[model samples]
Target chain A: MLATTIHGPRDIRVEEVPDPTIKRPTDAIVRVVAGCVCGSDLWPYRGENPIQAGATIGHECIGVVEEVGGDVQQFRPGDFVIVPFCHCDNTCAHCEAGVQSACDNLSMTTSGQGELARVGQADGSLVAVDGGAPDAALVPSLLALTDVMPTGWHAAVSAGVAKGGSVVVVGDGAVGLCGVLAASVMGAETIIAMSRHEDRQRLATDFGATHVVAERDRAGAKAVKEITGGVGADAVLECVGTDQSMGTAFAVARPGATVGFVGVPHGVELPVGKMFQKNVALRGGIAPVRRYLPELLELVLDGRIDPGRVFDLTLPLADAPEAYRAMDERRAIKVLLQP
Target chain B: MLATTIHGPRDIRVEEVPDPTIKRPTDAIVRVVAGCVCGSDLWPYRGENPIQAGATIGHECIGVVEEVGGDVQQFRPGDFVIVPFCHCDNTCAHCEAGVQSACDNLSMTTSGQGELARVGQADGSLVAVDGGAPDAALVPSLLALTDVMPTGWHAAVSAGVAKGGSVVVVGDGAVGLCGVLAASVMGAETIIAMSRHEDRQRLATDFGATHVVAERDRAGAKAVKEITGGVGADAVLECVGTDQSMGTAFAVARPGATVGFVGVPHGVELPVGKMFQKNVALRGGIAPVRRYLPELLELVLDGRIDPGRVFDLTLPLADAPEAYRAMDERRAIKVLLQP
Candidate 1:
């Protein structure tokens, strides 16, 4: 089997690897049909995070179950499924409480950008597509439900986006664009997207952003406030985990508003004093994509949303290095890889 | 008029000061019926906070309206009112959103310990007791609504305390004890009070704390976890603003739980990483007491709750210095001053 691996900064390669096998009775061998590069993947590619030499990478994918362990009851061979970025038993206290990201028995979905991947907790982690695999055109959208779309939905829910509420989405990455979509789906009356790049701003607009602010920092918050009639947004989605983005998210939130952050935090310090004084709340973290998979999959399959448009570039799995480079240099919003 | 003034650290004095008069059309002059020393008052008393020489200090009180300016509509002379620690116009965007603490035209109640105090935004800041002044025995409870009780209610509401949920309160001050009462009113099934002091623990048990954890830091969190069957509390109230208290607040919160904080923040930094990873949320600040005044006041009037029990000591107006000293020395949970 061919799998993606990283050796060091900017070093991505697709090489021959041993095929995955059912290691436990609750495990399944998934023949990945589609996998995508994630924004977090850049952390190691850019050396921002320590990398384990030649570690298998990628956590988002849609695939067909090639084989299943004896204990896996819900999924079987020939079933199409979405693999959540994180695996959970779905029965633990936290998982039962809808916080599957903090499940007691949690594991990351590594080796998804490969010909075959072993999925643990198969009965609880995998959400199979009803009636088998659908049209090829819907693959990317279905693949999105594995991580990004649900993450965006989590951000919107965490921010408490409600009908008739105004929302500000910080960051223009795929997740941020998805946040705009989530807010739209949640019936937010006003959606503000902060993006400096023209292409991302256009996508943001198409994804239901009523206003786009190309400014950064204070100017950007000022722009959002102006759009919200000088009172700031009713809810804020922080999709980029940087101090500047977090600052803007908090700054543009009206008193009693919440900032739902889905971005993996990096060098971010919360403004506790300002948050307290303004009665602003901070919520969110690793999204419980597994918890939201079933509902979101229905939305995607019903064509109510087209989150797959985020995949601006696609390539064969053998071109893993190029995929990493494209996302690393901002040439692609997100890259889909066919295995 | 006699008022409490602070000249420096440990310099609380009962001194003659000019009586308050209407300074704005929205102002009402309140004749103090009862003013209580707060936990926050000790900050300057202990020299932890910089003192402004000879400044009038108390901010919690129930009073009778002595006079009202032309624009004061809801409150009139002879009406008794609860003066919220923070005053707001009640019609501003933030106030309309139910976060009066962050009202656009916000002010503080600074002269409540005096014979007469001027309250700005009178129509918004003063919640007049219906049917005129009530029995004297209820004065202390009405005073509690001004700050402590509503603040505790805000913490519980912010933490999303729902029926049958479990709760943990991190501080043992009057506000924290009030938090125990708030959680009880909210129908939390298991209320854990973290307090080492026998007096406060007794009060906590009386206020609906089903369990008392006398440990500090890790041990306290451990005890809470044990009480909650190792799943941690569903909601946590961070009533003390110190970093250690905040740490314990976050430490004992279950994943997807919220920590509602109301204590004046002092050198507290949030554990953002832990919060993100565990999906724990942080909310609350200077409470929007005015928003919650009506409901909580009704509860007190109905004798369903007795938040005023937190006022364990009483002092005459001339004995203001002793009141401050008793509170500073932890000899009283809270002190009520009659002017």
Candidate 2:
């Protein structure tokens, strides 16, 4: 099998690697069918985070079960499944509360290189698709359910976007575009996607954003306020984790509104006094993607949401390094890799 | 008229001061019947906060309307009323949402001394004592409603102490003791009061606390977890605004629960990462006392709650500086002054 590895900053390579095998009773060995480049992957890719000599880089994936361990009862060989970025045993109290990202057994990659990927305490980590391997068209949708789509959904829902709320989505990344779609599906009456990129903004608009403004902070907030009858948006989805985006999200929301953030926070500090005075809530983290997979799959299956639209480029697994570069350079909104 | 002033940290004086008169359209002059010392006041009383020399002190009071401005319509000149520590117009969006502390025209303290108070936004700041001029038995309760008592109620309620939910009240002061009562009134299945003082703990038990513990942090959180079948309390009212107290509240709450905090945040800082992981909400700031006045007044009038029990010490208005000293020295659980 082939896997992508990061050698150093901006240095990505695809090479032959040992195929993964089931190790735990609850585990299922899945042969990767498709994986996509994630915005978070760029953290180490851009050297913002330390990178090991070689590390298995992808988390968002749709795969076929190659084998199942003895205790695995929900899935079988040849079944299609989606695997989330954060692995957890589904029965823990935190997982039960749908906060898998904070699951007691949750694991993350540090300055370590990968070996055979082990889905720890797998029962809650993998969501299986019905029956046989899924159709080719469903690949991006399945991969998305594992992270980006559900993450976008979490951002929208956690911001407490109601049926008729005016929502402002910050970030023009794939996840932000997906958030616009998620807000629309959740019945948001007005969706504003803040974007500077033409292609990404188009995706946001197509995803149901009623408006787009290539602005942030005071300017973006002012535009949103004007559009919202002087009351800011009811909810703001912060897909970018920087302090600037968080501030923009906070400033663009009305009193009693909330800001849902799915991006991994880095150097972001909350202004407690303002949040308290405005009565704004901060919700969302590494979204419990697994929790929303089933419902999201239904939406995708019913043709109600086409999350795959976020993918602007797709390459064979052999070109994973190029895919990373394309995304890192902002040349591709999302890169779908066939494995 | 006589007034209490903070000459410096740990220094106070009781002396003659000019009498207050209505100064705004919404103002009401009250001949204070009773007033009490507050824990927050000690921030300045202890010299922790920068208090100007000889600044008038007290904020809580219950009194008879001595005069009213042209627009004061809630009470007649002879009516008795409760003055919430922070006056609000009650008609602002925040006030309409029952968040009086965040009202657009937040009141600044006008009367600084021995009870006679000039309350701004009179209609919203004053709650009429319609059952008649309150009796001596109701005096303390009315004063309690002016600040600490209602603040405690707001803490318990914001913590989402649903009927039959298990609760933990942190803090040994009057507000914490009152929180135990508030939780009991809200029908919590078990009320655990965390206090070190035997007298305060006894008062907590008398006020319906099911259990009392002196432990805090992990020990206290562990004890509370054990008491709640190892799942932690359903609601934790943090009445101490210190970093440790906030940590204890977060550690002792079950997933998806709320930590209601009424203690004026001091050196306290929220553990944002932990809060996000726990999915526990931090709600309730300075209590909107006026918002709860109506309901609390009914409870007091109906003989369902005796918040007066928190007033363990009573002194002549002329000795308010001594009351402040006793409280600052931790010699008095709460001190009341009769004007």
Top candidate on lDDT is 1
Which stretches of candidate 2 lie above 4 Å from their native place?
A104-117, A229-233, B110-113
Clashing pairs in 1: none
lDDT of 1 at B269: 82
Single out the weakest 10-residue window by summed lDDT for candidate 2 chain A.
A108-117
Candidate 2 per-residue lDDT, tens place, B173-240, comes to 98998899999999998999998888898999999999888887788888888888877777889898
Which residue pairs collide, candidate 2?
A: none
Interface RMSD of each: 0.6, 2.8
Each prediction's TM-score versus the true structure:
0.99, 0.92
Q: Tell me the chain A TM-score of model 1.
A: 0.98
lDDT of 1 at B117: 84
lDDT, residue A241, model 1: 89
Q: What is the DockQ of each candidate?
A: 0.86, 0.34
